[model samples]
Target: MKFVCYTDWNQLPESANALFLQAEKDSLFFSRPWFENVATALNDDETMALACVVAGSKVMAILPLMKSAGNIGYALKHRYTPLYSLLLAKDDQQQVLACLVEGLHQLPLEALLLEPVADKDGHLEGLQGSMQAAGFGCDRLFRFYNWFLRVQGQSYAEYMAARPAKLRNTISRKKRKLEREHGYDIHLFSGDDVPHKMPDYYAVYSASWKANEQYAGFVDTMVARFSKAGWSRLAILYIKEQPVAAQLWFVGHGKASIFRLAYDKAWKPYSPGSILTSFLMEYVIDTDKVEEIDFLTGNDAYKQDWMSDRRERFALSCVKSVKPAGWYERFVASLKRILKKQ
Candidate 1:
């Protein structure tokens, strides 16, 4: 196996793109345009160095990575890029994983930080073992559950019937109360209209609880790229013609992800967010024709109420043996140990 490092987005070989696309999952996040957009938006101090594992003429696997300098070999990861692992073929998992581990050892980073890794397979375990064997220690920062609802072969009525009775009744009550106070309106936008409606979505987002959260600009960049490819889905819910709740969904490859959402806090008493989600689920299943909907991020009550099952996501930190990096790692480990004792 031959390992190649890519410093520029254009330097990525076409075969690597094809190999990633053939993967059953995480294909959208690892796509060519997505990688380019992420590299384009990299911070000044960071540099892109994507690694690819090749066997003869065929690209076997790809790892999305970035580099930076720190007291140790700490690296910064893109927040919006939730999942990262070796995108490889299923048939050659052993060989691909071995090559990937070897390539990872060659990276200049002292510690690799990756989060929300959807370890549907045992890849994370394999990576950890490889890193440990190479004289590195693996630490987990945290883990969260990812919610998703499969809508295939189920009508809106059938799906609602399967939901918890209390949740159903709560949604019904909220819908009725909200409609009685001020009639509601729902608008679905896609294609060219999606980008045109981003300002409207942002207006609602700024008023919601997450208004102080940074990365609106990053969201815009993603929206622009996704919109250009007709992968953007925006759903707005208005009360008395005033926008009260909105959700920005990114749909592709038969799956729709609820990328971001917000609702007017004043309507919290009436649960406008829940009402909008209920309405949108029906549309997402019947109109949008997606097989499943991913409520990306969070293990909030609302997500549990709506989603059928969840996948586990993890944050992995692997520290290699470099003097500066080792010192930094030991200091952090000691600090955490002391805090836990208290």
Candidate 2:
């Protein structure tokens, strides 16, 4: 297999081909644009992308990683984390993962650290072995759920009926109340509309994150990067003259990725967040563009009602070069082991 390291998505091919063909059907998160757009957004940071191709022709495996200084770099004195690096490929996940691990060792690096992997139910088997075979071990660093709302192949009525009776009642009541008490209107920012209106969306994102004592987690940069790469779009929920909540999602990758969320505190009781999500779900079903949506890697009550299926993700970290010398590194490994207990 020919290993190709690309600077950006433009260099990647259009078809799933040999390596990515399975990924095209199995995973929305592994799509080429998802990696390219996010990597480009984090361009200011130290990140590298490598694609594995078989015999210099077809794409076989894809890996995306960012240099978080907290991880152990080429030298052991400093620590860094390569955030959200993942393997994207199809068929025989075990073999695909094994190949990725072997390829990683060949690259120049100290260690690899991935966080916020989704805790899906079932299907997380043998991933540790793949990483170990590649020179890394498994660890549970952090937990999150990628929420999704099932779309495509279902009518709006059929979709709404699938929810629990209480959920349906609540949603209907809330939608009505929202219309009665406040003239709330929902707006969608398709990938095409993102560039022209993102600045305004960014403002709401910044304010919402700041109020929550956080930033939008690199969202503004990520959106600009994805939108420019022609991978995704921004959806904003506007109330009168102001923006209440905004979501950035992917359209190119078959699994629409829920990348960002920013909301106004004033509309908390009105549940603008859920309302905006419902709007997008409808849009997806109506457009029939994709079969599923990945709220990627997080489990929150607000985001769960719409999810049709659950997936468990495993994080494996290993280094063949040196056993970590520091107590903290050992402590992290210990913590990883401890997570299974919880």
Candidate 3:
């Protein structure tokens, strides 16, 4: 087995592309297009690199890495990224992970930071173990909470019926009130119409309570690319032709991820966000028939009302103690831990 790092996406071998295709079957976040968008939109001072573990002509694993501050590395991720991890081929996953861990040591990195990794999969756990076995000091830090719903073969009506009575009533009452007061319309755009409807989405988001997007054009470009791939589920709620709420969702591999959601503060009293969510939920459950719905990040109380289960996301910080820089990082980490304990 050999370890190879490619700085340019175009320089990646065909074998690597095949591995990415296999990974995409698991989550849209692992798809090449998603990674490309992240690279192009999120990159600032960091230099992106694709680290791979190859056995002959076959690629075993691919780690999306960003080199920053000369010797420190991080996952190629941004605030918009809900989950991040190394993409590995199916067969011999343990072996491939070990090889990948070994390959990571070949880089000039003293410390590597991987964040917002889902805890459901054993991949990150295996990676932690492998890094420890490779003589690296690893720390697992809590990042955020992820709420998700498992459809479990239930119809949309059945699913709604099981939700909390208060939630059901609120959605029903608010939706009715909003429609009666302003004649609201909810539109789900997935394909050719997504690009054209982006202006409405931007308008609603800008008027919402959330802060402006740190990376300009990131969400727009992502929605456009995912729309072209037939993975977008952009929903907009309009009251008399003015957008009041907008949500960007992606449906792929039997799962729907709620990527971005915002509602005009002016319409918050009418609960346009919740109403739009309810509409999107019904569509995904009854029409798209997705097996799972993920509320990707955050522990907001409202998420629990819609989601059935909660999972934790964590950051894996690894330090190569043999290097002086790594030793300094370890000292700082140890000091922080001690202070927290106190």
Candidate 4:
């Protein structure tokens, strides 16, 4: 295998095509167009992309990367995309992963920080071995707990029964409230139906944030990229003609991701977010379209209520330079060693 690193995307243009195609054919996480679309949204400094391929062949796996000054390795994205991103590829995941580590070693940077890695095995194990053999037992962070509902093998009712207790009760009661208290219509954006509803979607998302004093332009960014890449959809629940709850979902391959959501402030008492999540799961399970539904972040109470499974996603930190932060990092290491001796 050869690791081909390029400073520019156009430098080895065919490489991306071959690698992306291979990812589409094999790997679920790598198949989504919006993965790259979202990664491109995070390019604050120099963006570096790498592809690992058989020496004389097309491509095997690719690594999309971005370089910042110190203590940060980006998933190579533009400012508009999500913070957690890496390249999307299918075959030879470990090869692509090792290539990224090796390629980072080539640069004269301080440290390598890959935040929000999606597939834990594809990189974590192989990269950990490589880093340790080189005399570095780098830090791994369990920053966020990922939530996912397994909708592939069971019916909605069956899936509900498998859950603990309170969740099943909530789903049953919420569905009843949605049907009885007021007539609720659930609308989802699909295919060409997206454009007409984009503005309304943005209003609900932004307003939801404004009420809490936290703002995320990520909603608008997600809409445009998902639409451009043709890899996303939105589901909204309306009560009496006003949009009360909205769930924004993007599908890439057999895995569908529910990343962001919003709801009217007036209906917080009704638990709009929870209801929307439950309904979305029902929709996916009923259609049998996606095998896994990823909440993608947060160890919050809501995730436990919605998802049947949990996977902790970790960030890999490999220290490179002996500069300023490196000094503090060394001090931290010394502290750890002293603590161990005690």
Candidate 5:
């Protein structure tokens, strides 16, 4: 196998295209479209590239990477990205990962940082082993918790019936009160309609309690791209013909992920967010019939009420011992660990 790096998407070989097509069957985030949007939307001081390990005409593995202005390397990710991982072929996983690691080592970087990696399938463990064998000092640090639900072939009604009584009651009561007091409508946009409804989404987001987005056009770009790919599930709640709440979801590969959500703070008393969530949940469960529903990247109390299982995301930090920057980083990390223990 030989290592090859591509700084531009157009330079990718046909084998790279074939690899992504196969990988995306497991998760939409593994697709080229998703990474392309992320690379385009990020407005940071970093140079993005794709590092690959290829064997003749076949691509064995790929890693999306970015080199920071500070000379450190990181996974090419955006604030909105929930999970990131190395894309490796099913055969010779360890060998492929090792080759990819060798490629990463060739870059002029002092250290490598990757975050929000899902480890349920042992990918994290595999990566750690490869890095350690390559003589890098690595640490696995906790990032955040992820919540999800397994549909298990249940109908929407059956799933709702199994939810907590208080949650069910609140959804029913709040929805009715909101409708009776000030008539409301919930619309789910997908495919062709998504572009037209984006303005409403922006309005609702701006008025919501969350802080302003750091990257200006990231969400808009992602929504447009996902919509064109038939993976968007954007829902807006309107009261008196004005958008009061919005939620962005993506459905693909038998899974639905709740990507972003916000509600007008003025409507907090009416619980518009919860009411809208209920509506979207029903649609995904009954209409889309997804096998799993992911409430990605959080430990908010409300997430527990809606999700049946929990998992953790972690970051892997690897430092090169021979580099001055890496040595300083190692020292700082050691100090921090000692302080935490104290």
Candidate 6:
């Protein structure tokens, strides 16, 4: 395997993108455009690099890393981005992962901080084993659940009937109330409609309780990119042709992610946000034929009601270079030994 480290995103060849597209699974975060957008948002505060493994003309794997003090952080850092992984071809996952770890071992860094890695169907097992074998220390920082809904071959009514009666009742009542009192309508803005409808989308967002935040700039910058790439989903709930709530999603690889959402606090009583979400869920499953819907990152109380199945996400710290164990590391290791003795 040939390992190449790239300090410039623009230097990556077009062929590299084609290789990623052909991978068994695509990680939205690991995509070249996503990395570029993130790097653009970060400015020069942090450095970025792409470490890729290639065999002759084919690229097998790639890791987009950000440089911080002495550690290499994941390319994107945000709450909405809960899951991350190396982009590796399906057939060469093991070899590519192991090779990537070996390359990391040669880098001069304190540790590689990878977070919110999916616990199921992830490379944690191979990653941890390779890091340990390379004389590195590996530890799981924490774990959290990411809720998702699988779109089985069932209609929206069939799926809705399976939900709890109380949830079903609440959704139906709120939906009807909004329609009856306010004449609400849901509009989907994707493809060409994204850029045109963004002003309306932002208007509702500005009226939301989460308005005027620092992340707005980043969202604005990235939304255009996502939209142009054909993955943006902006669904707005309108009352009298004015926006009240919006659900921002990113669709790719047959999966749709619930990226951001908000509603006008004035509509709080109407529960327009919840109504919009429910409507979009049906639209994606019954209309767009998406295979899955990911309620990314958070395990809010309401998410549990919406999604019965979940996948765990984990944070991992792998020390690439073996130094004398720090006091904290040694203490934690010893405590584990003592606890096991019990």
User: After superposing candidate 4, which stretches have Cα over 4 Å from the reference?
Assistant: 21-32, 43-54, 77-103, 134-137, 164-181, 209-221, 228-230, 321-342
TM-score for each of the candidates = 0.84, 0.67, 0.92, 0.76, 0.91, 0.88
Model 6 lDDT, full chain set:
0.73
lDDT of 4 by residue, 1-342 (tens): 666766565565565675565554333345345454454455365556543434455555455667655544545443322224344355666666566566556656555555555545544456656655554446766555777777757877787777768767776677787678777888888655665676666667666744541334444554665566665678888888888777777775666777668887777766677777777777777763777777766778867766778877655566653445457478446434433442
Model 6: worst 10 consecutive residues (lDDT sum): 333-342
Model 2 weakest lDDT span, ten residues long: 74-83
In candidate 1, what residue range of length 10 has the lowest lDDT sum? 69-78
Better of 1 and 5 by TM-score: 5
User: Highest lDDT: which candidate?
Assistant: 3
Q: Which candidate order results from sorting by TM-score in descending order?
A: 3, 5, 6, 1, 4, 2
Candidate 1: pairs in clash: 72-325
Per-residue alpha-carbon lDDT of candidate 6 for residues 49-87, written as tens digits (9 for 90 to 100) = 787877777777777777755444454455456567776
Better of 1 and 2 by TM-score: 1
TM-score for candidate 5: 0.91
Question: What is the per-residue lDDT of model 1 for residues 158-226, given as tens digits with 9 covering 90 to 100?
Answer: 889998999899999988887788788889888778878887787787788875448767777777888
Tens-digit lDDT track of model 2 for 177-213? 9889877777776555787777666767666634532
Root-mean-square deviation of Cα positions for candidate 1 versus the true structure, in angstroms: 3.8
lDDT of 5 at 58: 87
lDDT of 1 at 325: 44
- Check candidate 5 and list the clashing pairs: none
After aligning candidate 4 to the native by TM-score, how far in Å is the CA of 246 from where it should be?
Answer: 0.8
Candidate 5 ranges with C-alpha deviation above 4 Å: 322-342
Q: Write candidate 3's Cα lDDT for 259-299 as tens digits.
A: 88899998888999989999999999999999999999889
